[model samples]
Target: MNTTETARRTAVLQSALAKQGIEALVAYGSGPRESAGMLRYLTGYMPANTEAFLVVPAKGRPVVVSADKNRARAFKTRLGDEMKIVKTTDLTGALKEEVASAAPRGGLVAQAGEFDMTTALHAEFRAILEPYEVTDGYGIVTGQRLKRTAYEAEKHRQATAIADKLVAHAMSIAAIPGVTGPDIMAEVEYLGRRLGADQAGCWLAVGERPAETYFDLFELTEAVGPNARVQIGATVCLDGYYSQVLRIGMFAEPSDRMKEVSERLIAMQDAALARMVPGTPIHEIVDALETMIDAYCPYTRLSDPFRFQSTHAMSNSYSDPGAAPFLNAGRDKSRDAESPLVAEHQVYEVHPNFTLPDVGHVCAGDVAVVGGSGATWMSQYPRGIVRLA
Candidate 1:
């Protein structure tokens, strides 16, 4: 991130903090495996083995606290002298001191836990900052992450392009005779890493006939027959942004029944994409998909054992909000389907899958971005079946 972008994001978050009556904000990341989102968002640097925290007050320059001197020196060189980088053995003490320095008045302080806070970390934070109120700032950071910046959108586009390339490569490999599903999966993972992907993972299913079972990489051991149908669902992450591509391929000629089912599934996906415009409620998008499925495949009910989410938010994580918005036959009041609106620059993976009684299971989808007027696709692979010779 450049200086201009950093300034813009800091201003945005500080404004949000002021509005929420928060005097200071402390965003923490415990090593590389946990709570790295907010820390990366603020510093543009991801921690590998050390814990880090970013302190942003209602006013003033932000201070970054690194767990060790080595990491602190590296950040100092990277972020320059404009931003303060402090080395501290006691992370909670450093956080309290920085917050107190920023907000001498001792108003409410928000700590971003990212997902959920563990009891140990929460108790430690509370112990140091006595008399001052501490609240969860996960929403404050994630709310900003939901709307992608131009830089973030470009990163997502690159990630999607990589996913499309991998899908095409997987299709070509799946067409080869005597190749096992696990072999193809290994090649996909290898190529994804060679293409500069930070992390890559996928699910592969191969069967002579359409099988309702969708297996992950570990479960794929059977050799793909000459005329088997293959399904590849791939996800690639580049620079912390993620994109997905799901496709179906056949080694031999697709039968008439396969073509009909593939067409119906593609039509339903297309209808749903058409309605994914800016400002549209998530529930309305689900409704449009449900209607299309009923009009085209009336017998297909949401009660089918193989049904999955129709739409889901995508970002650095595979599932942004984690639990995605789904469409069901009967309105289940228990689902949180309402209130979230698709805003400009938001990316969603529109994956819709259903089981066909005779032909097994059919699935198709790609990543799309919500624009000013409508949604545009990030992945360019064709939606229908890709027949291979």
Candidate 2:
């Protein structure tokens, strides 16, 4: 977190506050399980305990509230004197005190209730603030985060590198006969940690017959047989940022039909990537993808239960914002709905998964950064089928 980055973020947040007529903004995050990313995004620090709060007033320096004083001290060193640290036992009470002290007179306040604020906590804030109106602050923060900064893009690149390494390691071990889904999953997680990833995990499915429906790695116990089809969906997080990489592995020779379908899927992925230019409407991208898949591989149309959308934005957290801007046809009513314009510096995962008529599931994608002219892939691993010995 450099001075420039901090200044940029603060400016954007202050602008948002002015637009919303909010006198103060409060964001909360519990550890990894909940709103941790929100806290990390605002303060460049994550809580070691149950919860942390970031209070940004319309004026004066920002303050970070946490239950653990020791953790707060550590953050103070990194964040410098511009950020004030407040240690308290009562998290919500401390927040109310801060808001009251900052605003004094009753004024509109915005709170990020979506992340870590529970119903009781929200009520506590309202009751404590009294006349001050509390509105949703999630959009204000996320609106600024929708576009990645250069520093953020670099962190995502590092995270995606870790994900690529994990996927490569999983593919290397997946080819051996008798390997189970959990086997590959475990190796990926282990290697991901060794590579300095904050956390990592993936879902795996393995089966011999091409027609055999894949099951979760937890529920499946059968060893992968020769000619097995494997689908691995892997994610790696580094410093609160996340990246996803999906791969398909074939243990033995692929049939002609399987080869054809895999080629078509890869082509579809390439076409989608080509369209991820800055300012392109998300609906146009989806329309082009739908047209291509329908024309090339009609069997894997949107009507198929196995088909999924090819584009999704990835950032500080996996599926941040929660609502996917694009969805495969027939899956969501908003499939054709317009989404925010694709802006430069935004990152996305282009995983297009669908099942072939007689073959199992096929999945392949990599992290990509949107560029002025087009999108550039962060993960260098090949995008097509991986044939294992």
lDDT of 2 by residue, 1-389 (tens): 55556667877797779777889887777775447766667777674356777888877788888877777786787688768888888877787778777675668888884445678776775676676777878877876777677788888899999888887888888777677777877788899989887778887767653433333556767777776677777788887688988877886677787778778877777787787888886555556666776775547564565666666777666765632545335445454454667778778777766665556566677788887788888987777778887
Candidate 2 versus the native: TM-score? Answer: 0.86
lDDT of each: 0.74, 0.73
Q: Write the per-residue lDDT of candidate 1 for residues 206-258, one digit (tens) a residue.
A: 77655554446567777788767888888888866779899999866788988
**C-alpha TM-scores of all predictions:** 0.84, 0.86
Top model number, TM-score: 2
Error in Å for residue 261 of model 1? 1.5
**Clashing pairs in model 1?**
none
